[model samples]
Target: MARWKAYFSFKLWLYSFRLKKFLGYWLAVFSVIWTFTEFSGYFFTAVDGSPWKPNVWGVIGLGIVAAIWMSRPLLRRTVLLPDQEVMLEIDINDMYARQDGAWIIPCNRCFLHSHIDEQAIVVQFRNRFFPSPADFDQVLAQVLQNVPYELDTVRGTQVKKYPIGTVVPVQLHGTRQTAYLLATSELTSQGKGDPNLNHLEDSLKSLWSYIAENGNTEPIIIPILGSGRHRLVVSRYVIIGMIVKSFLAGLAQRKFTKRLTIVMQPKAFIHNQYNLDEIESYFSCAGKFEFDSKGL
Candidate 1:
């Protein structure tokens, strides 16, 4: 019964209104080509008194249309802002893949939450970039060595509390890409990840500032903030909206990276059932806001 429900859900998305909008684009293009051939006889011509046979061409056109429609789910949506200098891409892929741009790793204020499970993106990123835990820690220590921290806001077992929205950049040992660690949560004295929506917003703003000053105009890649273990009692869609809004708002203050890619894991993408078309529309609407490209 569960399997049947899942199957039906998949079918529903296959014919969803959002998918129709995408398919409409390709279908219109096909129509134009088909009409052009009818008038110009570009590919098909009448032979001996028999009219040009469109059967073969029609089959080929339908096949091409089907291929285009089926490929939609496999592709992500990308949008360029008004200035056209920056771009935003949304994709369902592995963030740990050795991409060219820098990535944002959400970390606790302490920056040393060693409880293992508490670190989701952090752990995955470390395993991919560093040889072992010790190696990653060595690099982290060096990066945070002189960084200032706050004495208050200590909760439960956490002692030294770094203020939220702290951004620290760590260059992966072997790769040209850098990992910008943003403090979005505080480690509970028990050493669990504790985060709120406010913190996430602040962290995103700080992230843009750091990127503008130090990101060197490289593309910035990030995962959906407030997801996984951080516990923001909101849907992934809302979290995505918040991230977009904050990033755009930051852009208003000053231009940051040339591109920002939001990478969502395949599991999260399917389980959450994100409608890319709707998200794309939201991005377009968000871009309409008046923004100052110059630094404030």
Candidate 2:
């Protein structure tokens, strides 16, 4: 009778373990699927109802699944230091302070300039308050002429440039017609400082041109222009969102591929105050890249 009882107890333990493993696998698969679906539904839905409202149960289930999925990987992968390769360089103070590599300097005068050897370039500012599209075009033409690279624009789509170390600008012209201008200004002010919206726009146009011409192969490098000396108040997420939106717009139009690499200088509060883990989390969540000055 005792031997029979032991056999039953062992069978129960084995069954429980197998059940736990099975539950874990499904949880991870569902969480990823739900997250992706939620994002798509939110973007494509035209109605006013909350997308998350319908997925509340799925979200909860995903959370449970994610918890289990994360645990197993914790032991296998060691979080390495943020070491994104340097594809291009921007002439920010900190970036220069850290490395003496080929640098891109914004001419503040020439709408656009590219120094291929140093893998550096600059986008000149056109205005303080707001510049018109004509001004942006003029600046871009100058950039094209001076910057030793090809320009490619298609059917009002974003541009593309080649050679991994390219300097692209994110221009912000206070043109009301331009979607997300106001939002971009608010974001710029929050992130760096007041940036010349026109310069931002011109830069973005130039960026699209570069993408269109060269195709998105090598990662491009850029600094938070208005956010720095320009004093554009904006969050990192907002800036990233704008950039991504532009990239996607180009992609949708079949202008270029979607490969992109964005770089930014750490704020004083962050560099001076936060530890490595907090900073790592911030950039990692924003996008994949190394935080070192080597790849300014």
In lDDT terms, which candidate is top? Answer: 1
TM, every model? 0.77, 0.32
lDDT (0-100) at residue 107 of candidate 1? 82
lDDT of 2 by residue, 114-217 (tens): 21122222223223322554665564554355456334432343343332223433334443211111112221211222355554555555555555674433
Clashing pairs in 1: 156-189, 157-189, 157-190, 158-189
lDDT of each: 0.71, 0.38
* Model 1 lDDT, full chain set: 0.71
Model 1 segments more than 4 A misplaced? 1-12, 15-71, 150-159, 291-296
The residue-by-residue lDDT of candidate 1 on 1-296, one tens digit each, is 33233333573356343555556765676676667657666555677755465675775677567646654443367888866467888776677763868888888887763566634888887776778789887887777778776664444443456678888888865668788988998666666777678788778777887787777777888998879878889887888877777777677667767778888776666576667767777777767776442321
